[model samples]
Target: MQFVFLLHEDEAYFEAMGDEEQKAVIAEHFAFVAALQAKNAFSSGAPLAPAMTGKLVSVSGVEDGPYADSKEQVGGFYMIECADMGEALDWARQCPTAKYGRVEVRPVPDYGG
Candidate 1:
């Protein structure tokens, strides 16, 4: 099974970090990803820019940025192929982001065409 882990962080919380502290936080996750890849437990992952860079595209509605002004925003994601949800969640638990915000583990839909 494949799972997509959504790493959410409080934008303000992250921004509040000192430059060195923030770099350390990012580096922690980078090391984790590399380790998982070496163990063949990681598929792929990447950090997302702040939500302020996002656009709300509504067909006939307003398209806007800075989305909701919420404290929490999705900061990144990882797609992992695992034997089961249990295994995937174990990896999620190791994420450094968990210390700061929430990690949403969602199963990717399988659309066989």
Candidate 2:
């Protein structure tokens, strides 16, 4: 099974961190990825820019940022192949974002066409 971990964090909380503290947070992610790679569970992952840089497009027009204001925004994502939800949950539990944020674990469906 494949799962995508949506990392959500409070933008303000991260921005409040000192330069060194922010760097350490990023380093934690690197270490987490390394652990996943060692287990061959890491498929791909990358952090997203701040939500302020995002845009919402519709048939009528485009809106700035998210449709609604929210403190928790998706900060990044990680794709992993695992044996089952049990194992995937374990990995999610180890995500660094869990310290000051949330990690939403969602399964990827296999489509046949």
Candidate 3:
């Protein structure tokens, strides 16, 4: 099975970190990726730019910034192959983002079948 982990965090939470602290936080993500790769579980992952840079498009018109009003915004995601939902949950628990944010684990549906 494959799962996508959506990392969500309040932008302000990261901005409040000191320069070194910010670097450390980013380092944690790098380490997590390395760990996933070591287990041959990593598929693809990346951090996103600030939410302010995001754009939303609807049938009516295109708009600037996120369309949803939520305290936490998606900051990144990781897609990984796991044996089952239990395995995916294990990885999600180990995700660095869980420290200061949320890591939502959702399985990818196979529409081809």
Candidate 4:
């Protein structure tokens, strides 16, 4: 099975980190991902730009986020192919973002059957 891990960083937590601390945190994540790649447990992932750079185009006039009340936005994600959900979650738990952010591990559905 494949899993999508959406990492979300708390706004307050992020703001609390100094510039160097923030960079260290991001470096930790990069190191963690590199380790996963070395072990062949990582497939792909990338961090998203700040919410200020995000566009809110909803069906309804629900322009939120940068507009207002946007907390804990998704900062990044990892897509990994695994033997089962257990393995996938194990990988997610090792994510550096798991320290201050939530790592949402959800299996990707297949409709090509």
Which candidate tops lDDT? 2
lDDT of 1 by residue, 1-113 (tens): 78999998888887888999999998999888987888787888889988878888777876656776567889999988888899888888888988889899999888985
Q: Flag regions of model 3 displaced more than 4 Å.
A: none
Q: What digit string (tens of lDDT, one per residue) describes model 3 on residues 1-113? A: 79999999898899998999999998999999999999999999999998889888789988898655997899999999999999999999999999988999999998997
Give the per-residue lDDT digits (tens) of candidate 2, residues 37-107: 99999999999998889999989999888544678999999999999999999999999999889999999
Residues 1-113, model 4: lDDT tens digits? 67899987766687788999989988998898888788777878998876677778877755545655557878778888788999887887888888877899999998898
The candidate maximizing TM-score is 2
Clashes of 4: 0
Residue pairs clashing, model 4: none
Which 10 consecutive residues of model 4 have the lowest summed lDDT? 61-70
RMSD for each of the candidates: 1.5, 1.0, 1.2, 2.4
lDDT (CA) per prediction: 0.86, 0.94, 0.92, 0.81
- Tell me each candidate's TM-score: 0.90, 0.95, 0.94, 0.82
Which of the predicted structures, 1 or 3, would earn the higher lDDT when compared with the native?
Answer: 3
